[model samples]
Target: MGVDGSDRGEGAGQLLADGEAQISLRQAEIAAAADALRAGGLVLLPTETVYGLGADAANPAAVAAIFEAKGRPRFNPLIAHVADLETAARIAQLDDRAYALARAFWPGPLTIVAPIRDANAVCDLARAGLDTVAIRVPGHPVSHAVLEAFGGAVVAPSANRSGRPSPTTFADAVAETGDKAAAALDGGPCAVGLESTVVSVLEGQPRLLRPGAVTRVQLQQIVGPLAEADDDAKRSPGRLALHYAPDAPVRINAKAPEAGEAYLAFGGGAGGERVFNLSPTGDLAEAAANLFSFLRAADRTKPSAIAVAPIPEDGLGEAINDRLRRAAGFIG
Candidate 1:
């Protein structure tokens, strides 16, 4: 097929097949994508969660390219993607606790930071010189295949530029990285639209750096009674007060009142407002999946602002609240 006439790149014009998994490629194309990574170019690849803009973590210039491409902040570190536990350990200094956690959650949406033994080998910027690196062993076949072919760790952040919604599909990735990325491997919509949960294991205690598909309770089950960071705790990379927010402001519904706000209810609408039943009948899983997409769509209406109904405080509700609280710009 002819490339699209868009300014994005040579293949920008190819028609996008809808809901089709045949977007799968030949082995040569995959190898070419891997070659791009080894040669210090960016490639947008799929993960079980979201698509990521990837470059060689060991090459500072390549890693910097990711920051530049995404317009990401220097303070916000990137996660290193590996194919397996052995590769993850090779890149980061893992302790026994970290090993135990990895054994339980290595091929899933959990990232752990461990000290870097050879910071020089990896881009100094990749670690932010903290002696630790955030690393994950992805479960997605395409990502694992590419990482294994590349024969080195790839530093990746969400394909979108800083402060934007993450890319869950190839088109979203291309829209974010433009022609700068060599290729974007489309692997269908991401199962989880959010980034991975990040934990710091460099310290003796496992600290929750960022919440993602892996819940705090799940982590505690793997380890034991993980400590929550204090409200006053200094923010780490990706833990900003107003992060993962849409362009429009968000408000949480503390109680059902008579009027004056759009409702994202547990189930059926209360009526007389632009109501979005996040999950009528209180289904948190459905609500979580719909959160970002709904936020994106709601922003289009350009409402004076958005108001969200309250969700339970436990389970996935914690994650929903966490995102909503940030969207509302609550510092505490």
Candidate 2:
């Protein structure tokens, strides 16, 4: 597929280098990125959580390309990103709980998985052939513009290669999958550096599949005593045993850095060249935004391991600790 059904000069995989793929948030660039998606090509765009590798949700070949490019497991479903709640309804059969959550968190960093409404809106491969589909309305202006320009649902997973940390900065996104995308939107650094909190409303009770910028407490207020993901975990992405990992191993809840370990401090207690504080003031929101970038930076130092300071398991800290536990391959 190509522009107006005409062939593009090259396949998406043969696109230019990362530098050339980076596009600004100007109108022309956004239109070009949308065009790429229409022609069955991947587009790397920003979201409130992290940069996502996007493909037309309805295009089977285009969706397949995303899995191939990222080496992502097909069993792990992808989230269909839409511009508005109206578009989201076309793909997911949202119930009362889903609508309640969406009304409170749509156009933000919360993903709701519901029974499939319009099967044609999102392809089987994108949903991993499940009856449920994960959908979200991103808060980032750049991604919102692209979605409107594209005029349909776009299934986007984290732009990083399979199980690695999601790219919070545009540079890291380009480094991960820029070569495979037809175009990329540069939205600078993401504000919410974690992935969206995934919740499934398909069953009788709402379930939290994965944690992210949206805290459990925030979701609990809307849905009331959310259930934990059991077999339903297969309906969500980022549920793998090992995820958001860096090149070096990670050690969580460490008091201080070891001889060769890089310290990821929570409160501003540690100092030194090797130590990277998540937040100088012990702010959970600040730590959440700084999590992935700090992990990437600490990994670049080539330390034997990355030791993380204890983060309170409340509100946003819950999401942060979840990521750390996954990074250390402790829990799924």
Best by lDDT: 2
lDDT, each prediction: 0.70, 0.85
RMSD of each: 7.3, 8.0
Worst 10 residues of 2 by lDDT: 1-10
Each prediction's TM-score versus the true structure: 0.84, 0.92
Q: Give the TM-score of candidate 1.
A: 0.84
lDDT of 2 by residue, 1-332 (tens): 10100001121112211212332427798899999999999999987788999999999999999999999988889999998889998778988888888878766788899999998899999999999999998777678778989999999999999989999988999999999999988777877788988999976789999987777887888889988998899998987879999999999999988999999998866898889999999999889888999999999999999999999998888789989999999884
Q: Which ten residues in a row have the lowest lDDT in candidate 1?
A: 1-10
Query: Which regions in candidate 2 have their CA more than 4 angstroms from the true location?
Result: 1-25
Candidate 2 lDDT (Cα, 0 to 1): 0.85
